[model samples]
Target: MDSWPHPQPLTNRLELVAVPRPVLTALVSGRAAAALPPPLVTPYLAGEECAGLWRMRSMQLSDKPGDAPWVTRFVVVPGVSGAVGAAGFHGAPDQVGMVEVGYRIAPEHRRNGYARQALEILLSVAGSSPDVRVVRASISPENHASRALIQQFAFAEVGEQWDDEDGLETLFEMVLRTQ
Candidate 1:
């Protein structure tokens, strides 16, 4: 896979650290951090559930190597060990210039506003890109926390969809105004 410069999205309390394709491969294999590519150190290790997400992201990186920079990233506090969670888009913007985002905070880190911070960073990136016209998020109806998060960003309820893995999801979208 071709490498891209790491883009670390920052906030007052967090940074979304890029996970290179090589390191993603190592993560899928359940390898230790030492097995990851040089000069990269991630404090987070994927749990079984997160590992499944990582596997999916690994395949995504394989299919669209250029989308690496927009894929999953570690959500960490500066100088902190272990990520508070993970966040990113489903992939690069689609043919119609829409991108879907997903984020998850570790159980222990819940309610600390990490997910909200990550979502802000993701939206900022989408808004700044000329290639992105719509930002979408599909949240499980039962996931009240995430449903509430999107509201803060002015995303409107557009529709619904059923996913093979996640079942029913309430789709929300925010259309970016062209400059």
Candidate 2:
């Protein structure tokens, strides 16, 4: 089990656990039902909607063995046995010290502070990294909740882009640290 990165001041209610390599493998191989026992894997994690994302992460791990810590993580409550959502950096900081973040809260888990907590955790991690100077979030224009969440952190609307999978996205960026 690769050590999952937990760059702290951790949130009181949420914990981000690294999705183990075994779990990713099972998810990408479509053998989660057989490879992962119940309660160890969530249906959302193994579902079709997230299959491509998981596969992409798997490819990242295989291509860059040291990037495990920067990949997908399960957002769980400390005392809770299951995850409420997923969040993490798109990858390690780029040459210019920018790291993009992505997150999702399960439908049933939405409307709570989980997404906010997850963003806080991601920003904490980014701020702790010397190589990370800018934290970026590409939210769809229709994702009002995410747009609002980043606004609370003072992220500037730097630009926008077209994602083949997610449609048009508004790009937001915040300095990782005041420095």
Candidate 3:
């Protein structure tokens, strides 16, 4: 029932915020997609498939009340000197009080630690929320960069899952209780 807030600039290096449908449409249909890899194209093109993702992001920025429980998405736009990045929660903060996080850096933005920076921000935000007790990340077994980024957060290898839509992925979970 709580309304979400508008996008706010963070650390002068990124903006943790939600994006509207029109802007999402533009990003997917415009040159933005051109800067992403093949794996990100389908979700950008098929809004239906990404409806939950979009709604989560919307709710994060919405002022409307009585919104259902959902995950939040953030567009990681780097500061004046950096390129755009993308990241989001996988679903509503879970019943077990865990949330999953995912992210991608534009091909041009890789190797600059943006993914790690974004993950830290997300984890901090989620951890600060009373409803969130843990944060999880599922990455493809072969994605070394993703695995490495998550390791920096000290997320332990909990298990693996056979994603019907994504083949096999390794699931890592991290406790986010107050330090």
Candidate 4:
């Protein structure tokens, strides 16, 4: 495969790379079916039931070459320990100049600042992209950790959006020009 663009380095602890199939398979297989989170499952199975989290990981990794203009997927690989903790993105590539980020950390890797580190790297990468002028994070209002993480990146509250699928999401905006 050709080298992916904007390969940003996370904290000295982790590295961000294009999400690959084998890594995704390992991530889903490492977790039990019951322990998997709902949001993580739905998109992967196309709203169908699955035996493990592999379906979700598969969906995350199976980014077609020409699916969307603004969307991208990446794997969070730990540098020191060489562990693959999670996968995430820079939102829909076709959404004009707007860049949104979404992500999920594995159950075993929670509370380790992995999410924050990975998000910062993604934000930096997105900000550097010529196609992206602004970056946004649509997080759940009640998700204190996610809210706090965005705050650390200086994402200002822009507005709120309610979707049939994601429900009420607090839209936070950060301008790359200011960074």
Candidate 5:
């Protein structure tokens, strides 16, 4: 358990909880089903996959240098109960000043404007850092909903990349206004 509290502040119907390695490990090992977080409803989008991704990100950050939070947070809706999904940065801003942001909301939580609000959290957090100048997001071309969510921001289609699972994905980039 982590003593430090670094939750993302939001002004909506949700809150962000830091998902530590232990919790993630349990989730992946199927132990969370018995003792999951109170706010997390049963069958939490099968977080096992996201936990695997989190482990990979953690390994990369540990093997490299610089400041990377390497933290995955759960989207908790207090009164409604249960975590909708997860969101966090890929890593700290690179030397070239680019940071990648990723997020996913459960199918049940979609169409409720949670994604847009969640994105506001990402943008605000990255913008608060002095070293971060640009935020990147890559989405599958067939994911019209995600594209629409990103369109709410000032992001532009910069390029594309091939993914093993998602195939060719369209990349969007946004330059943050740093003072």
Candidate 6:
């Protein structure tokens, strides 16, 4: 990843803020600012659903040390400018080394290429990890932007699933090119 335009500094644009469950709980409780200090991007979303998911996962994945750092990350830009949104693995790889990915950019940051850049970084991480073989993203049919983003790589439509929160979702998957 040396070719990445942004320096490796933690505060650089397109930073990945690791939200371990404890950190996420702090963010939700307004204690993260003091506890974690600077450069750790917190959830900027007003949506309670996303916040709750972070809290719930904190307990669910508590025992899995590998998932704590990469499960959910805030996508920040402009060298500590702040979080524009988030992207991360839904969880650690399953028995077959498959993991799901999800990402969202803030409304104000749309069309800024932040989401794409963040997804690329995340994919790179997953691709290089020995534990991850496939990455999947579930998107609504109406989300043309999301569809286009995944298509930028070698991703393909593998299937669909029904979700209580999002209804029917089209599943896209990519076998990581590790070689």
For all candidates in order, the CA lDDT equals 0.79, 0.82, 0.60, 0.56, 0.70, 0.72
Error at 27, model 2, angstroms: 0.7
Best candidate, lDDT? 2
TM-scores, one per candidate: 0.86, 0.90, 0.66, 0.63, 0.82, 0.78
lDDT of 2 by residue, 1-179 (tens): 33233344453557677888888899999998789756546787778877999999999989998888887788876655567778899998888899999998878788888888888888888877899999999999999988989999969999999999889999999986644
Candidate achieving higher TM-score, 3 or 4: 3
The true-versus-predicted C-alpha distance at residue 23 of model 6, in Å, is 3.0
Clash pairs detected, candidate 3: none
Candidate 2 vs. true structure, TM-score: 0.90
Kindly list the per-residue Cα lDDT of model 3 for residues 91-123, writing each as its tens digit: 556668888887866565679766776777677
> Model 1, residue 100: what's the lDDT?
94
Model 2 clash pairs are none
Candidate 4 stretches with Cα past 4 Å from truth are 1-11, 21-64, 67-74, 79-84, 90-92
What is candidate 5's local distance difference test score? 0.70
Off by over 4 Å in 3: 1-12, 25-74, 77-83
Superposed by TM-score, candidate 5 places the C-alpha of residue 87 at a distance from the truth, in angstroms, of 0.8
Q: What is the C-alpha lDDT profile of model 1 across 16-109, one tens digit per residue?
A: 7787666778789888455864333344455576788788989887788888888888776656566677888899998899999989888777
**Sort order, TM-score high to low:** 2, 1, 5, 6, 3, 4
lDDT of 4 by residue, 120-171 (tens): 6677677667777677888888888889888887789989999665689999
Each model's Cα RMSD: 3.8, 2.4, 7.1, 7.0, 3.6, 4.3
Best by TM-score: 2
lDDT of 5 by residue, 78-140 (tens): 566677887777777778788887888888788987777667777777778888889999999
| Model 2 alpha-carbon miss at residue 133, Å | 0.3
